[model samples]
Target: MTAAAIGASFRPNELEVRPDGSGNLLGSLCRSCGAHFFPIREACAGCLSEDLKTVRFATEGTLYTYTIVRQSTPAFEVPYALGYVDLPEGVRIMGQITGVEFSDISIGMPMVLVLEPFGTSEAGDALTGYRFRPADVTSD
Candidate 1:
């Protein structure tokens, strides 16, 4: 598979975190409707316009909804929290919640995106994925 296809399969529409370790998340914005999208798209779904612009998301958002997955799945690790986060720019994104236990997640909690290794790409190469963590958690 091509690199683009592998990236698309691994991250879908979310920004590509560079392998060199810059740790930047690239997102897509709709120039026609002001709608933001993760993983940058060539076309704007909101306005059906082809003029989509690429930008970096703030990485911070409010927790919208979440669930604890007790069952194991090939797509993700077990005992992980999966949820949608509402970005300040009015975009909602789906990602896994990390750095906290399932018992601590609450609706409307503040979250920030963090780059972490998720799984391998479709081409059997190491792939990095984004996960949400409580904003209050410090690097220390």
Candidate 2:
């Protein structure tokens, strides 16, 4: 890692990147209803319970669906693949698809989270962010 990368930190909300390059998505787990939510809610929507705890979601998920995005805001580049990945904890996460050709992505392929430099801070510091990538595996 470069010196800038070593000093990078994730933006508050969905990501929690560690210094060791091992991190997970931030979410809320409801102790009452056993439900998980992304973006860390203070209360559980499932059971309307306030007994929620902040938790880190799993890094791996299965691509539930995808699309080729030809239009987006200026901050993002065009013609990117976007998808909703189904995590093991029952939360569906939306991220920019990466590490594979658009034609190769499928509805059920295994995916893993990977952190990259998303942008820079106002003070010109690197900001870490995440995206989903193709899982390492071989076909039978």
Clashes of each: 4, 0
lDDT of 2 by residue, 1-140 (tens): 64435535556678887877667899999999999998899888888999999999999999999999999899888898999999999999999888889999999999988887787888988788888988974222
Per-residue CA lDDT of model 1 for 39-94, tens digit only, reads 67788878889888878778899999999988976765577789999988777888
TM-score of each: 0.77, 0.90
Q: Which sections of candidate 2 miss by over 4 Å? A: 2-4, 137-140
Candidate-wise lDDT, in order:
0.76, 0.85
Superposed Cα RMSD, model 2 = 3.0
Worst 10 residues of 1 by lDDT: 1-10
- Runs of candidate 1 exceeding 4 Å displacement: 1-13, 19-22, 122-125
Q: Indicate the residue-level lDDT of 68 in model 2.
A: 94
